[model samples]
Target: MQSITLKKPAPFEKYNQPVGDRYIDVLDGVRAVLVLLVGAFHIWQQSWLTPHFTLFGQRYSLDFLLRSGYIWVDGLILLSGFLLYLPYARAEMGKMPPVGPFLLKRFLRIWPSYALNVILFFFLAVEKYNGNGAYMAKDLVTHLTFTHTFFYDTYYGSPINGGLWTVGVEWWFYLLFPLLGRCYKKKPMLTALGMMTCAFVFRAYVSTLTDTRMWFNQLPAFLDVYALGFIGADAFVALRGKLLQSGKKEKRLFSLICLLCVILLVYIAKAQASSSGQEGIRLGQMAHRFPLALCLLVLMISACFASAGVRFVLGNRVMRFLSAISFQFYMYHQVLCVQIRERRLIPSVSETPNRDSEWPWQPVFTLCSFLLPILLGAILTYGFEKPIIRYFEKMRSRKKK
Candidate 1:
């Protein structure tokens, strides 16, 4: 029995009204999940617990789940790429947004909340300065400018939230998005290919360096990730547009997308099992970032095109709430995990901060790691983020008048 008598999808507008952010609930849900994955990995970092099991007469390890957290950061990066270029993708069908308002909104949305957190953490982690005024000053400067990733001192071992490297990368992407978006608007596939090609060349160049770990995470390394996001956005819009246009319930298409997502997940786990290294897993990313990003794209698209029940499962009210505060959650979780260990908030017998914080504390610390981020993220999002955003928006309206 044929599932979908697939045919050329009608023009996008014939199905959906327009490309607007309101209906993209699944994206926020996925963002919530990605942030949680990253947070879990960081929590696991303090306690290197390998969770495995035996089933169906075969032993399998879920260890890669935590180990692969950093890779999921690429997923977040890809999401950023999708969002930044989504307007351009839609412009393939309709008019593009004015560059200035869009840029202003993006910067205003991120900077206020981010700057507050960075400054707060600066005070919290100031001990890392060790009375070395020079280093503290340098770290603060780089963070303020979003150039922290460009320097070794401010990157992997950064005193002010090592996880912040992603912010720096995203900021760079934002600064360049206008140009990238325009290029994509004019020639999307070509622009994506060009970005991916340049990224590969850049990675090859960086690999030649004496110690590539410090340099591997710079923005250029993840260009392909961003490029994939652009491609994914365009594809999602077109595919979903057509799906809606068919006016036929696509249970089969939904089933196929879900199966493909599952297959990709299994394939990735197998790849992780095959690879053995702690080196760039910081060392290993460059080798397979594209395929992984592609897989992420599939999952993201699948989520979007899923059945109403599946979409609601992912984009439910709870997920929406978490997604709203995901940025703050991500920023706070790892740092709080470290604080929990350092302050002995959870009892630990490991005198030297051992990998296994032992049974009670491991679970306790991980649980706190999960909860504290939400509490803090909610505080920042509700208390500070909303009011500041409204203020800027009002100013924009006044200017329009």
Candidate 2:
């Protein structure tokens, strides 16, 4: 089959909007890092690493490092909100495509790859279910409809595919974007504050009703994170020129702030792991969600105005390639990694049979887990996603004509 190619918009295209920071290559680098972090966390969790290991004669556990990987999911959420909101913000200014086409474009962009995974997982579940009729039926219905995150019983149940709960959350956000766009267009700061307030209040109320950690899977719990992105979009539009022309001192300041955000995030993750233990990590994550989101927002915005050294690192060719396939990588990595670990397809690092430290082999497994997803993601992107997206764009264009 021929590959699909999307035509670039002409310089003076009628619908083109000079949205702030049209494309920051560094953000792709950030995405590459986030996906890898989440990938590494999954590998570490599934590996045969012992609960405790002695490093440099000191006993330590890397559980916190792995647990902290969950925060990157919020990072992904923030990025999505930022990117999606930009076009909507532009549309609000009457410079971009209409809301209907934008929504359709979003649906077409996400659904093909996501639907394929859902189908693949559905069949996998069918094989695994055997004679468990009722549960299988329920899982199929919930997964198909993306309603798996709404109910405690269903959310906590055996998910057809691991790491897909976010799909439901993200999909709902897409549905509500038009409403959120209206709020943002009228008063960006109030919209952001309202979203944050609603998220905190909803989370607090839900905590009283149930102790389910899956509460984070709901869209309400992530409203603040999404809102932060919306705010960032508005900021970028208003400040893009100033940000790009920032002087050496300003760039240095942004770098320092980015570093501080990283340090603060690591500190919070470590503190949660140390004080709460593994079980309490979820509650810790909940408690620190706002802080984590804020740190991510700062990092993202800073990356836009980063110095040459930072830009070079983030905009490297390999990082950009990884970022391009990030969606597919994210969608497929957990399932593949878990299967590889469960099957013991490769050796781990630990020389001893105690499964304590699998250094060399652990790295190999991690590399494979990361690469295999990219390979599959590349195929999905080229073979399925792009073609379907192009087809939809053609339909929209023809309608316009």
Candidate 3:
């Protein structure tokens, strides 16, 4: 008897509501885990032991580990593409009209805490500026206008948290989201590949240049990361339906391949880190990481697309809580670290001179400043983010009514 192979079915129709199973929510938990880990890394930098290589190697302070956590930033960029755009992409693919207040809702979601963070930074920080007053003004204006990363260099000095650099990048993404949506609707696969290629080329160019000065000041190039997020969003919407429709054998096989890819990518990244030669570092930063980030984004969406059991694990209540709190945790950490440093609450027992004390505290300040910020960030999220979101939503509802 001849074996009959059934033709594959078409993908599932998209949903109007941005619902993913418990798996996606579990991915949210993963996001929160990443956020908290990065936060802890930052706080840990206050003071930690320095590992010496050849006595000339830079002291391996707690901050060194924190700095190494830069990978988390890449994780975040990927997650932004996966989570933020998932709902809309699904709705759009289904031909449902976008929620009436989509842009307004997003604006309110981001603006409140962002605005508050800036104000808080200005009052509590920013006074340490040694640059010209004009530079300071330009910085303040550009940051407020969300044009600093693309149009100006505002984060050069002062107590402006280093973490805020991603904010400027994110704002540019917000401005271009509609265009991204249109592009996804038109030819998502092409758009995804194009953006990924562009990101690779930009990073490659930067790596080759001895002094990446131009790349440092360049806006269009840096926009690639955020654009990658948009592409990831499109992929999530496109692949999810296909994955769901695949046979059990195919699904299992695909899952195995994806898992292998992720493991291989991570191993490559670890190898790149270990190489430590100038070339290795550059390649690790510019070349290996983008693929790693893309793979991470894929894995996240895969969890959502996986079997019901997988989805249940991903969307569990604990995961949802973590996802909800992740953003707040990310933003609140730097301020907390700074405040602790200022108060000398994290004591530096090291005898190194002030100039030489790269790690301020001897024992690692990561754990010391966490409790306060975690507490405060949770409060602020409730007070600021929730209220602003609710206010805008209420207004939108009233208008519709």
lDDT of 3 by residue, 33-149 (tens): 578757755664553334444446654333333445555666776676665566656664566335435666667777668767766776565566664678667766766776665
Off by over 4 Å in 1: 1-22, 50-60, 92-94, 245-249, 349-357
- Residues 1-401, candidate 1: write the lDDT tens digits: 86887688644322133223435877878898888888878888886666779999999886777777667788899898988777677664367778788768878888888888789899988877789988888888889889887777877656778878888888888878888878877887798889999899988887677678876778888888998888887887788667653332563476478678768866775566456655535446777677778887888887676655566666678998999999989888888988887888877777644464477666777778799889989998999988898998998799999
Estimate the TM-score for candidate 1: 0.88
Candidate 3 segments exceeding 4 Å error: 1-23, 49-67, 92-100, 130-132, 150-153, 213-262, 275-283, 305-314, 347-364
Better of 1 and 2 by lDDT: 1
Better of 1 and 2 by TM-score: 1
**Range of the 10 consecutive residues with the lowest summed lDDT in candidate 3:** 10-19
Best by lDDT: 1
Considering only N, C-alpha and C atoms within 3 Å, which residue pairs clash in candidate 2?
Answer: 349-358, 349-359, 350-357, 350-358
Question: Model 1: how large is the Cα RMSD against the reference?
Answer: 6.7
Question: What is candidate 1's local distance difference test score?
Answer: 0.77
**Backbone N/Cα/C clashes per model:** 3, 4, 14
Candidate 2 TM-score to native: 0.85
TM-score of each: 0.88, 0.85, 0.75
Task: Flag the better candidate by TM-score, 2 or 3.
Answer: 2
Candidate 2: where is the Cα deviation over 4 Å?
A: 1-20, 48-63, 90-97, 275-279, 347-360
